[model samples]
Target: MKPVISRSFLDRLFAAQDYDGLVQLSSFFQGTSTCRLEKADYGLPRPFFLIVESLVWFAQADRSGVWTYFEATSAPRQQAMLEALTAGAPAGFAQAYAKGVSGWRDEAGMAGLDRWLSARDDENNRWLWQLARANRAQIDELLS
Candidate 1:
């Protein structure tokens, strides 16, 4: 299936290293559905989908708190969020997320996660963009 967002648009955002834009596009593509998405739904590569979805969830967590993130997030999304954070976010940010998840249903761990995310807000975005740039070959189809 083809993407609703258009490859040219994606290519432009990618070339500009617009991580936030890419993340927003993913949210746009998700529409009103709260369900976890499969790559087949959007036709984006797995890595692209992973990073974008992760950022969306991370941003929500950053703004609302980790407790909220856990409450709304599905099981598959939870795993993908961890994968994206570990793969591209700063070590401490990923560690904080993991630690926070240890007691996700309780406020104890979520408080520290909220603090940690608030302290270093937006820094992880660059790392995710850098990861995409590093994997240019994998996303070359966007360029084509």
Candidate 2:
């Protein structure tokens, strides 16, 4: 089912501009079955993208802390949102996602992921990047 988000909620999200609020908004989607933004038919696509950009900004600002919270609370929703964007949104969304990943890697000094990020000639890198971006918990679990 598509999650119901109100305009006020969107306003609150936009106004928050902090990691705590981002976590709260993301956790709000915890039990959602789907995050098909297009299927949401909410007619507020701009706000949705704004939220995505805001998330990217927050992730860029504090990759380690924000990503830890995201892994713990928002990964599923984020993954689903990316799926929806990949399936239907314009190409810019993917570009935004890539930029977010770039910022995170660069700011966090994640040298280990450089090969994956630098393999721009390989189309598979996109999927790998998406997987890495979405599956931090899985990565940790496997390492453990």
Candidate 3:
């Protein structure tokens, strides 16, 4: 069974900007295993985006850590998780997984995000992309 992650832990890590802790937590998502989220304890009622944003921040903080985690996970498993997370996500959360995994540009997985975005024409998707673009500098600064 996969390890269960409490929303309180996520809240503490994110609030403290604990990139190392976030990377360590992501290791639980490796391989074909799924990590369970304790949704009720989350800072926000809907915690999916909160988790995704933290993952994205961690990926930005340490590209090698993100690459290592992805390398250990199968493509199909990764794709399934991506689809599930983005399916009915709110505006900025639409491309969360894509933005997180796209850090590994040398891999074919990056192309999937481009394709996914290309196929979408919704306002939320557009706003998500724009928000990502606008926050690029801030994201980089956080990493620095």
Candidate 4:
């Protein structure tokens, strides 16, 4: 049987900017669906439906915390995390991407992530933007 929220639902979930609605939808998904949550599935149960749903929700609810997680994490690995977050990949898939990008690390790459976060205009993505704009020192302090 198809999951309560299918690939199309996941697609819309990724594009959703309304943080409140996304939260409700995610809750509905969790309650009504048989799917299991996995970071590798982008917080979804299925790979193709990876939507970064959890991270987006978490980012919306707590920007500083997300940034702290990013700052405390390695740059290259974090780049992959940022990519997965942006690309709307399955939850834990980012770790694999981080492993792939382990060879390259630079301030420019880090800055690019900032720009990417800043450029996101979606309502759901705004929290990510907020987290991105937060000062690194502040993030470190808040997270620490």
Candidate achieving the largest TM-score:
1
Candidate 2: stretches off by over 4 Å: 1-73, 98-105, 108-144
Each candidate's clash count: 0, 0, 0, 8
**Candidate 1 vs candidate 4: which has greater TM-score?**
1
lDDT by candidate, in order shown:
0.61, 0.40, 0.42, 0.40
Indicate whether candidate 1 or candidate 2 has the larger TM-score.
1
Candidate 2 backbone collisions, by pair = none
Model 1 Cα lDDT, one tens digit per residue, 39-112? 32234455566556557556887777778877776665566566656765666766776775566888766777
Better of 3 and 4 by lDDT: 3
lDDT of 4 by residue, 1-144 (tens): 332444454445445646554454445444433434433343333211222343442453245323444444455434435554556543443543343244224434444433443344253345442332333233222222
**Backbone clashes in model 1, listed as residue pairs:** none
The residue-by-residue lDDT of candidate 3 on 1-144, one tens digit each, is 444556565445445544354344334333112323332212221233334434543343344434454555456545554654566555444364566455654555555443443343244334333333344343323222
lDDT of 1 at 86: 75
* TM-scores for all predictions: 0.67, 0.26, 0.30, 0.36
Task: Report the CA-based lDDT of candidate 2 relative to the real structure.
Answer: 0.40
Indicate whether candidate 2 or candidate 3 has the larger TM-score. Answer: 3
